[model samples]
Target chain A: MDRKLKEAIASKLMLLATVFSSLLIFAVVIGLIQKSRPILATHSLSELLLSSSWFPLRGEFGFYPFIIGTIWVTVLAMLFSLPLCLLTSIYLAEYAPAKIRAFIKPLIDLLAGIPSVVYGLWGILIVVPLIKDYVAPFFGYSATGYCLLAGGIVLAIMVFPIIIAVSEEVFRAVPHEIREVSLALGATKWQTVKHVALRAALPGVIAAIVLGFSRAFGETMAVMMVVGNVARVPSSVFEPAYPLTALIANNYGEMMSVPLYDSALLLSALILLLVILFFSIAARIVLLRIERRVM
Target chain B: MDRRKIEEDFFKGLMILSTAIIVGILFAIVAVVVLKGAPALSLSMLTQTPKGGYYLGKGGGILNAIIGSLYLAFGATALSLIIALPVAFYLREYASERFANFVRLSLDILWGVPSIVYGAFGFIIMLYFGLRACLLGGIIALTLLILPIMTRAMDEVMRMVAFELREASYGLGSTKLEVVSKVISRQTLPGMLTAVLLAFGRGIGDAASILFTAGYTDYIPHSLFDPVASLPLAVFFQLGTPFPEVQERAYASAVVLLVIILLTSVSSRLLTKRWSRFVIK
Candidate 1:
């Protein structure tokens, strides 16, 4: 009887633990909503989201510029990283010998493991200066070394490992028989990889890119350091811009002094949470489909 | 060259070039931090807290941040393990497939949620409780941040636990709890350790989630409620200064943080390998 009672208590405790773990997401969403209720109650959704002005001191809370900034930086990062990652992953998957693959794989993992602040330091020291001295002057822009371009480049480098790792897995998932069939049909090795392996892995590769994009969208510290925290719509890649993550990171502490400033920041956090959650869910679904198909 | 041959060679060359660029970038990051950060890394910097005007390149060290980071990461990892292990066990032993998938999807979403969002959430919770930014708050925030990661990793490890071992335990008339504790735990000991270490590395290296909730201080924290300094925040604040020397100090701090992460990662790899010998593959 005592042993049965002990088993019952253990089972109950484990169930409770699972319930608590699963409720964390709902709790975060609720906490964000409750905190931002003050602002959400006062401002219309369209005005809050659509207007470009974000002067918090004057009580203007339009996040349109930040939205545009986030979109631009994320798109630029994707543009820069996707091609490189695709090519590298293809090489690692198809061309490299086992020894080379073994050697390079861990290096990429280490790259992924480096913290964002370290990436920020590298960006401030290296990429920003390079862009400022050469790329900006060539484009006839004054070089402050902190601009959307710098942010995009830093973020691209930061997310490169993720894309490479994911895409490499996707490429490897393409059955060897697929490549063999293509090669036997008189296709070159490159042709087999491009036409057969890549096509077979298209869905997984797209999922990988989406996951990479989500990571870039939500990246805070490194992007915040390089992207000149100016709250304006950027007209050019060289122009300074403020992303949503940067806005939240830079201003959340001081905004408590203002009446509605905290609310506005909290609301932005809500929007960020919602956006990332949507993309993450979509990516998970796509990945799940791939896993099921492979099984 | 023939058209097809030229196309193939050109694309292959592009792949090689891209791979080289990626490798080059990684080396450059490590080189810049070590080269620039070495001069500033002194025994004083590692053993003492910042003195007056440390941000202005004056005397002092980042010992406070170093100790504070270890405290926070260790505390948070311990707290997460209590909840994560049980959840992992529940998912593997009790839950149905649909429910397990739902739990995994939720954890995946949580894992992808930005660290900044966790900061905001923690800050809001702090405000509601009328508590200030302190080590406790930071611990709580980081616990939330790493919980999903720990649980998922442990779940993966537990799933790898073979079924025949559990059957043998049951054949001995053992209960579900007994089988899990005796059979499953031994099998997954290495993976659990690796999961905990990975979460620790992640928690220690993160800056955004603790930025608001931790509330940096120059002194070491005396209690859980006292605000504390951390290495990532040290790097952030020092780098923000206009003085060149302080910026160099910031790089030193980055190097410190990098070394910590590298040690955790490499040790975790080694530990995983070492412990895998005992695991029933």
Candidate 2:
């Protein structure tokens, strides 16, 4: 091939590749929409979104319980993890020695890289048994080893590393001079961290938490193993309940046997996709604000 | 005691305690997996396939899953590299800032989209083609899952390539493609390799995305059309069984997966350090 022609062809091919990569998001959205159209056409949105009964065999496909379950589990997890993660991030950013920070940071990243399934397995063997043996009894609930509380606890552990990693970055982004100035004003290290660094990093920390929330909400294999895959509105954290991710993960294969079952599963997936997209965009906006401030 | 001193001591103690808890949990997870799975980790488990009633607590191994996971991760990583490299190159070398940012935002959203959604998307694609759960479906799903991670990581590395080098290459009459292949890629090779390894780790460890798309079986796949087992699925299915022995095997499978991930993570860290020695900045 001519040299100029070859370069032109290569440039054109790269552009084509970029265009293809960018279209993946649209492709997923379109695929979900097309696949879920059957359910959308057959069922009312309110019924799908509000009703709690989820009997797919009888053609009842209410996702209300799963939504509630997702919210309940995710909220519980955040409630448990947020304070600890913040404290850990604060320590890593301000309190720990450089060597400690170096060692701990990668340890946290290692925790993050551990497979979700391993977390699920640990949840089954450890968290479930603990709940069944102790925590459930204290709450006057009989634990079957798989319940919302187990799922929430497992999820809390799973998201802890993410929250700590991001929030630590946010805390670190507060210029060193700001800390020095606060310390020079006779404020203790804790006081400076609380009054100055925390305030400045608030937006980024919230973005990190939001990102963690989306991560917990979309997590599947871990939650599926622990959150008793029963589709119902739980009366207590110790009760078996189904979250959206668990629902789709557990049922998509079997749904092919029934009418609109596949659609219902796809609809759940679509809902998850939209929820994640919203949080991701929100996180990016907050991160952009942080970047502007830092720069 | 001074008020500020007391308050500082209390908060510092709390922070230390929290960090302890986090580190403690990491140790606990590894300890429990090793304690339970060590007995079941055998050479035969690494070499043989499942026998009759393996899920029912009979003798067998997870060789099928090990091989299948390798096949899927390798295939998916190769596919993702083919597309992600070009896209990363385009973003760094050609695209407008606005266009690049928009593409990055889209990639971020795709990165956060739940793995289950990918499975569902892959399942839909399979249905449209009247295809069953097979290695190909799994690879396609995993490719999508790793695409953003690999591209963004590569883009970050490529951006770190000194602009002066590119200018110098152009001054020598190098085409844009030549500069990208020879100059930019050479500078970013270590980071790119780390990204690929990271993506491969993710692809191999993920279960939800491949749950239905891969359709787990006990045998090693003979072709792209064949259904394949994976370590995660093996662990998931075995752990779900009522048999105690099978559950032990599940733990063993998890140990295998954990080891693979840790190895990848460690190697990536080493690669970054080693290759970083060659980077100009």
Candidate 3:
């Protein structure tokens, strides 16, 4: 073949691959919806979302408890991680010396690379027992280690790397000139960061938070191991509650045994996917806007 | 002025405390895994498959899971690379900036998707095609799980290749394909290696996506269609058993996984430095 012809063919193939990859997200959504059609046909959307009773054996499949459980864990995780991660990012990006920053960056990256299962193992062995013995007792609750609190704590740690990494990048992206101007105006380092760096990176910081939220929301194994797999809405962090990921992971084995059990689980998966998709898109938009502004 | 100083001092202290906690937790996780799992670590555990009553705290090893995880992750990484490489190259060389950005947004969204959702999606695909839970199914699931990750990592690296290099290649009267193959690929090879290692690490560690797709078996898989055990699921399953020894084995399994990931991250760093020495700044 001529060189031009070869280039044309190669470019065409590349485009095809790009298009194929782009279609996968839609394919996942459609596939899940099709599988969930059976359960959706029997129950109204409201009934699925609002009802708390979850008898899979007899075909009752309300996801209220699981949804509430997921929300509780996600919200609590964000509450735990947000302030801590932001402060750490601020320190790393602005306050820390170059040597210290270099040392810490890899440690955070290593933390991020640790597998979810390992995190789950650590949670089960350490965090669970601590919460069960020390934290819960102080909070006036006698509880199993596997509870919403444990799930939240594990998830918070899991999200810390992403949040700190993104926010630190955002803070660094605030040009040196801006910080210098603030300092030149007689502002202290803390004042400049609070007024200049934080304000300049607000959208990016929100994007980081959204990204962290989506990650924590979808996390399965770590949260599954710690969260008490109870099919009820948790009244407190110490209460055992079943999140959607755990519900799917724990029951996939027996999904085929019961009528519509698999469908219900797929529907729950669909719900999780849709929520994650929304947040990710939102974060992407924010990130893209920031990129454009920087350029 | 005094209040401002106090406020700064207070926030500074808070930042230090937070950093200390995060770093402390990182060390604690490794320490706990090694300390808890070392006693149970034996040569046989790394070399042999589980025995008949392994789940019941009987003697055996997790060689099946170890090998299965390697096969699954390796297969998935190779498959994803085939697609991800083309997409990354096309984004940089052929596509317009706006279109590249749009595709990147899609990839970022996919990257954030939870692994459990991918598992469910994979299960749906399996049911559609009348396939069973096996190594093939697991590989397909894990490829989907890691494709976005690999693509994004490669794309980021490709973006770092200075435009001047591309211009110089084009100035030599080289075709776009030649420029991509001969110049860009060489420049980005190290970064691409890092992406592959990163994806491989993720694919091996992810239990949720493979839990249902890769049905656990005590023996090493003899065929692509055979159900295969994996390290993450091995850890999860062993921990579920009531026997204390089996639970201890779970910690050991985690140690194995931890070591693999640590090696992956460390090697990728060293390799990136070693390979970038020849590239122009």
Q: TM-score: which candidate is best?
A: 3
Model 1 pairs in collision? none
**Sort order, DockQ high to low:** 3, 2, 1
Which CAPRI category fits model 3? high
lDDT of 1 by residue, A194-283 (tens): 788988888889888887887898899999999898998999999899999999999977898998999999899999999988898877
Candidate 1 ranges with C-alpha deviation above 4 Å: A285-295
**Which of the predicted structures, 2 or 3, would earn the higher lDDT when compared with the native?**
3
Q: What fraction of native interface contacts does model 3 preserve?
A: 0.81
User: Could you tell which candidate, 1 or 3, scores higher by lDDT?
Assistant: 3
Off by over 4 Å in 2: A1-3, A286-295
Identify the CAPRI category of the predicted complex in candidate 2.
medium
User: What overall lDDT, based on C-alpha atoms, would model 1 receive against the true structure?
Assistant: 0.91
Interface RMSD (Cα, Å) for model 3: 0.8
State each candidate's chain A TM-score.
Answer: 0.94, 0.94, 0.96
